[model samples]
Target: MSTSLAAAPAATSRRRAPEPPKRTAAERWKRRGPLLPALLITILLTQLPLLGTLYYSLRSQNLLRPETNGFAGLSNYATVLGDEYFRAAVVNTLVLTASTVVLSMALGIAFAVLLDKKFLGRGVVRTLLITPFLVMPAAAALLWKHAMFNPLFGMLNWLLSVFGVDKIDWVSQFPMPSIVLMLTWQWTPFMMLIVLAGLQSQSTEILEAARVDGAGAWATFRRITLPHLRRFIELAILLGSIFVVQTFDPIFLITQGGPGQATTNLPFLIYQTTFRAFEVGEAAAAGVIVVVGTIVIATFALRVISSLFQEET
Candidate 1:
């Protein structure tokens, strides 16, 4: 009876658990205090610039001659909306943005798929692959325009000469394509990194499950991998579109917003308007529009994508 009672007490003790230690105030503050200050700083930094931009967007103050400036109630906005140049800029910007995003996503996915598999010299290939993205935009543009597409002494022309082909003017003949291709080359690695991250994050068990269901490789990708990567793909597009819309260096360096303003994007247009033409109010208005449009689109896309990830979880 004594042994039985001792064994019963031991079993009861095993069933009970010790209480977790309560956190002290200092410990709690240590964990969350830094985060609160960081969040406050982030909000202030972001909001202050936006508020200043909004203020400038409403005023007609030339940086060179502020004495002649005054408040313009929506006049700048009206002018920006009514101008043909602005309309063309909007279209060009959209096209460039779309082209960059689609091309980058496609090529990034292709390269990621290729790179995901083990291969010889993969390290060298990876380094070579990302070299273009790391090149300074100005240097890249200079090399493309002066050395690769200069019509006469350009490497592209020299290569074409092998087939008895004449040199073609890359910027003049295909202004938008040249800009699109250049930006695409520079930004695809951004997408590639995102896609590869997504691919690596995919659940191996889910893939095995698909394989056990007699799914082919294509079917497995369609049924499992793509679904899981929805969030990452959205991230790629979100970031890619924002940067593409604001592109300036390649267009400015390679084409100078021309062969007759053909390559003039929103950012380039803003620069030309404010710095070259001295239209400060109009340029600020343009900046405001670009910022608002970008924020709205990016926010909506991110929310949708975050919901997708949430649904899976």
Candidate 2:
């Protein structure tokens, strides 16, 4: 009887399924092995160029003076940093970036709030607004240069003549402002899209409550809408700063870093150093500095956004 009972338990145990084995890290990776090829390609495309740039930054790799090409240590960086042009470039970069970001954000918020409300043919209007952003940066800069700002024959001159005013040489007289205006015109649409998303995602209940409580449009905007869009505003400013600070196309196509280097930002300076002055190492170092500064700002912006998200949750 005892033997029969033991045999019954053994048979039941034999019929039962075993638990699945835990996957190791390698096994997990293998299971998702199809992504490996694409990831490797991305790394090759991005990381390889960055590594090459870093290596070149550490060496004296002048195309003009190949004989002087070798490991330069930090000498190239010192030279670039010590130059007066670099300091001026930094100042110009800050001015252009700050102006563009501020003006874009303001215009974007205004447009976003306006479009968020019901309107006739709003979709078509939104598409038209976003057209400038979709245009290529260089092409847009060229358009602004020749079509709008041309001293004698451009639209601005024509408009001034219509108004019985003096024609302004925009690029020659106000190079930085002209560049800022072009960039702001192009990038405002991007900021509007971001802010619009934030506006649309807002709590309808709160807005309706504000309306029911007799809160005016300005009051509601100040109390509820503005608070909600703060993070979006920060995000727009951060992104705009990153792109605007590295502006090259407008400076190149519109001003060519002139009216006496008035529009020469870091990227333009780097280009001037590399191609115009034939100082590859110095340009590489400047490029590294710009990249590092961008990364730092991006990190801070991301952290601020994350904190805002956490607060909401």
Candidate 3:
């Protein structure tokens, strides 16, 4: 009977398809212990605000109307979508983001290429070039607005005067262009830094081989350097667009969305809706839309940039 009982247990164990080995607590912790904490923290920080915003967006809460607040459903989204100002803000946001990112990336690539060569005072020059990006955004905007673009005593007008040209009101006369110029000035350095890193990491042997094959500077750059820099450029554009789309300090400090809402991007629009108009629900709805749009853009951008990691033919 004891033998039969032991055999029965063995048979049952075999028929059970041998349970997978149980991981030790230490092993399980080793696999996911570090990432679990960070993932939980990230979810807690990001999801909490998002949940609160979602709740707010679904309610008819307005600072102006204290007693009328209630469940509003999708009315806030409808209001925001139907508004002309929102539409204009969307367009302006697109233009501002596109222009700044493109110009900054172009100038950054140029500067990075030039700086990649061994030249006198290269360290000092690179440091000086990076100063603009390190400046606080509000301070940079203020510097441009008051010191560079002011029609009365700004340096730009003084320079124009030296050329026998009339002093022009920069912000009022060209609001969008003025904002673009300031943002480009500040962000180009950031893009340059990223591109320069990519340039320096390139294989020296590849460049030498291209030279040995009788490739001229332009040909080598067009075929070899440019291809290598493609991923960096895409990354720069992605990062630049993410930041530029949220431009607010420059608009607030320089143009104040003047010249009839010419410089108000989506972030500025959200600020206006929340504070100026006291429409909390609409602002939250706009925030949700912006988040959605950003996700959509980032999804496509990440896919494109992922191609850079594929084995090159």
Worst 10 residues of 1 by lDDT: 9-18
RMSD of each: 9.8, 10.2, 9.2
TM-score per model over all chains: 0.82, 0.88, 0.87
Order the candidate numbers by lDDT, best to worst: 3, 2, 1
Candidate 1 vs. true structure, TM-score: 0.82
So what's the TM-score on candidate 3? 0.87
What lDDT does candidate 1 reach at residue 55?
A: 82
Q: List the residue pairs that clash in candidate 3.
A: none
Clashing residue pairs found in predicted model 2: none
lDDT per residue for candidate 2 within 220-292, as digits (tens), equals 9999999999888888888788777878888988888998879899999999998998888989999888889
**Local distance difference test scores for all models:** 0.84, 0.88, 0.88
Residue lDDT tens for model 3, 183-220: 99999999999899889989999999989999999999
Alpha-carbon runs more than 4 Å astray in model 2: 1-21, 304-313
Candidate 2 versus the native: TM-score? Answer: 0.88
